[model samples]
Target: MSLKLGIHTGPQDLSMEELLRVWRRADEAGFHWASVWDHFYANPLNLREDPCFEGVASMAALAGATSNMRVGCLVFCALFRNPSLLAKAAVTIDHLSGGRAEIGIGAGWFEEEFREFGYDFPPLGQRFEQLEETLQIVRSLWRDPVTNFEGKYYRLPGAVGSPKPLNPNMRLWVGGNGPRRTPRLAAQYADGYNVPYQPPEVIRERLDALEQACERLGRDPAEIGTSVNLRFHMRAHAGDSDADPPDNYVPGSITGTAQQAIDRIGEYVETGVGGLNIAFRPPINWDAYEAFIEDVLPVFHTASA
Candidate 1:
């Protein structure tokens, strides 16, 4: 399948009405997917540190608001909630959206959220251990009639979650850049692998690693999909030159005019990325989103066609 695009609004700064507007607009514009992040605090520093809505609740709202676009959290922290409960929540959202919900999970990062919320900010290895267990439990809870899991970090004894997902084939996206454990987890338990803010070259290397991990598991590399999420900046002026991208540009950012953005996306496609999830640092750039959909997205659709 050709590449698809997703929008990440990140549940920050925007009021509830504005958030709803953005998701509805993306859905109406025929974007393939939309996501909000799982965070207790606003991510961008400039935003007035106001009330940030919880991730899953925001996704539930998005699912209720949009009919066509798939909506979910982008890489919810495993440490934030009980794994089985998380799975149940996803199933509920899926039913709400008529099977348009997905889950993107990762080992918890962002120490600030952890400490403030009183979640255990365990060591890296322990966190990965929890994440692996979480993935396994979530998959089992979604698929099995009665799930039983025993792990160091989490345990399930004769656990059964009813109202299985509306879509039996719901997707689980794994997000992380762990050179070893992350890719292996994606190979073993995920439908999709996603990396945030990594440039095309960095993404290519991760994809290579994932392929190798898949091969080791005797799984076809094609079985797993890959996507990159990055901060995006579109140079708005028509007179903007197609000059070389700045050397000091942020690591996982795409910044350029329409054609330049297209070329950058093309580089990612050439590297075998199956989707691109675009996020903007606040103040939210609705114009860039609209302009890209108008001017750049069609070029990709045409090329793929």
Candidate 2:
């Protein structure tokens, strides 16, 4: 199967102008997808309190701006908006993008953001329950003529989300790697599963779990696409003056020179990952982005073609 490549941008510390420039460039460069993260705060640990943009709103703007690249939030917190309303928003953005919209969602993490937003930070299990309900509600609103759902966390009485998504197969992506509920949930509900911030070994384990989930659910494993999200850091050469990696750099990021990035990404592809969502660390690293576009993307694109 062909590999799908995408750029994932964190909404923190970037102006709309910068975000547009990067995404538009990726679109013009023929990247398959472009994503923005959903967050009210800059980062979980950033004490500097950098500027952060709202995810869905940014996705709407991104949808309108890009012509070819698919636009979506990397993963919206399911608790951040009402399920039915989120369905409506997704539909709107899908129309704006002429059917190039993806819905990426996860159970809300980052407890502080929830508290500050006046949302209850419930236990993980309870949050998963909410996530499950949100998935069902959103899917129903998108596909069903009328939806009437009553769940522990959400309720919809004759909810009719209008102007349905332009794409009949609007992609619903579930992000995260919870050992039990998450994999099963994705098998049952999501069109795609994306595990972030993990190495190849961990990703292999999660994919195994996802396959098992699909088996238990009596669904075709091929029905659910698999992808990974990795942080990226690169430079023109090994000892270039501006080659220092980002301070927030964690282990397992796809880092190094152009050839190294090509090899590292290939490892995941070998493990049956069909897609990659890469977030480059600040200061945006156009040098790395340019190199990746020139040297790395073509390897996969040509293989696919």
Candidate 3:
């Protein structure tokens, strides 16, 4: 199946005018969507000292500014806002996009983002539990004109969220790779799954686990969207211990030529992934990204077409 190709909204500080300029280019370039990392920190991947940018709000700005590119968070943090409130915000952005928003979400992970912001950094298991509840509550808030849910962690005696999504079906993509709990949870609630940061072998293992989760739950893994995060670092080879990858050092992010990256996307497509949201190289690497878009995306687009 043909799928969307996109970029992450991290790296570099863009002025309001600059952000609009780049976003217009993204749309004009035929990218299917765009996304940004959710954080309150200044320098997670670099030492730029660019101030904090809220993700969902930026997404709304992008949605309003871009005519066709679907706007969304790379993965919105589950703990950052009340579940229902977040859902309402998403619906509003969806309206702005004319029904082209992807509601990607995940359990909060950055300790600094949490501790520094007065938010609790619950342990992973507990965080996952809260994430599960967050999904249920958010979806309910979107689907039900009014909802009353009383869970151990969240309570909504009366939940009224509207104006509902413009499209009859809204998409919710979840990001995670925990072999035990996350896949099953995605099967239960998420419309899509973002492959977590891992090596190719680890990705295969996680896909197997996701397949098993689907089988046990009587869900079709095919119906659940398949996606991955890719890094665009043309310099670092697989064996470079000294090479500092610009973004997350997820396995497979280190090094590749533009052609290698396209071939890798082919490999991912062969393994059933439907979309790839690439974290391009930093400001200095924009030339690399431009080369990639010119050389890689077209081949994949034509092949998959």
The best candidate by TM-score is 2
Off by over 4 Å in 1: 44-48, 239-249, 302-305
In candidate 3 the C-alpha lDDT for residue 205 amounts to 70
Q: For residues 82-141, what per-residue lDDT tens digits would candidate 1 score against the true structure?
A: 998899999999999999999899997788778877887889999999999999999999
Q: Write the per-residue lDDT of candidate 2 for residues 1-305, one digit (tens) a residue.
A: 25799888887777888888888888888988888888888774476477888988899888888898878877989989998888899999999898999888899789888898788999998989999999999999999989999999788889887888888889898998687788899999999898887888888888999999999889998988777888887676666657555676655577888888888888888788888878855568887788888888888852221
Give the poorly placed runs of model 3, Cα more than 4 Å off: 1-3, 11-18, 43-49, 235-249, 302-305
Model 2, global lDDT: 0.84
Worst 10 residues of 1 by lDDT: 240-249
Writing each residue's lDDT as its tens digit, candidate 3 over 221-250 gives: 888876777765753333433335543555
Clashes of each: 1, 0, 0
How many Å off is the CA of 271 in candidate 1? 0.7
> In model 3, what is the error at residue 149, expressed in angstroms?
0.5
lDDT (C-alpha, whole model) for all candidates: 0.83, 0.84, 0.73
TM-score of each: 0.93, 0.95, 0.88
Estimate the overall C-alpha local distance difference test score of candidate 1. Answer: 0.83
Ranking by TM-score: 2, 1, 3
Question: lDDT of model 3 at residue 293?
Answer: 66
* Model 2 spans > 4 angstroms off: 244-246, 302-305
Clashing pairs in 1: 197-252
